[model samples]
Target: MRSERPFSVFVDEFDAFASPAFATFLNKGRSSDFMIHLAHQTLSDLNRVSPDFMGQIMGNMNVRYIFRQDSQPDLGKPAKTR
Candidate 1:
């Protein structure tokens, strides 16, 4: 069943938030009516601030879109993050 009132969260420039609790919303916000969207420049931005969070961050996101200036990486393979 889907809710008529859908909820969404969009976080732009995601690397600015350094707190662990802020990231936890990605995990906890998954109600049937909720959607989460995150945007950032690069994966390195995340790795620099919190190396441990990559696993947690990737776990919650079922859909991923990667865009680069020169060329897009081959995203044919499935993500294998724990």
Candidate 2:
């Protein structure tokens, strides 16, 4: 099944539901008029799948927003050094 008009899909808790096919769609969806919005709590959630897949997801994302998070690593902060 497919839509004739452009469409969008919102996937929340993306890491819990992501698959190799999603990686493919992220790479190819734009031209096909498909937009996918993925939301997750942390990169660690995606990393649990595979670092390579996580990299794929991050690389394909054109926009990202980081809300308040407790972990410094999630905010791309370097760990404190003495």
Candidate 3:
């Protein structure tokens, strides 16, 4: 159910916030790991019971997908002299 167009647009729009949010969610709070673990467990349980449960959960959560793009120019193009 992945869409390249939406992922690309999301990454382009939210790349800046992604890293910060990930870092904060991973390291800033003592319960972050627990929250992630709980989410995984719930998803696993729901998946086992109903294949479409995860999609429903994500849709309810308003979750979005993103993809990283290499936007840098080729080095062979030559660097501007400072």
Identify the runs in model 2 with alpha carbons over 4 angstroms from their true place: 1-5, 77-82
Off by over 4 Å in 3: 1-42, 63-82
lDDT of 2: 0.75
Question: What C-alpha root-mean-square deviation, in Å, does candidate 3 show against the real structure?
Answer: 19.2
C-alpha lDDT values of all predictions: 0.68, 0.75, 0.31
Considering lDDT, where higher is better, how would the candidates rank from best to worst? 2, 1, 3
After superposition, the stretches of candidate 1 with alpha carbons farther than 4 Å from their true spots are: 1-4, 69-78
Report the number of the highest-TM-score candidate.
2
The most accurate candidate by lDDT is 2
Clashes of each: 0, 0, 0
Error of 1 at 55 (Å): 1.5
RMSD of each: 4.3, 5.6, 19.2
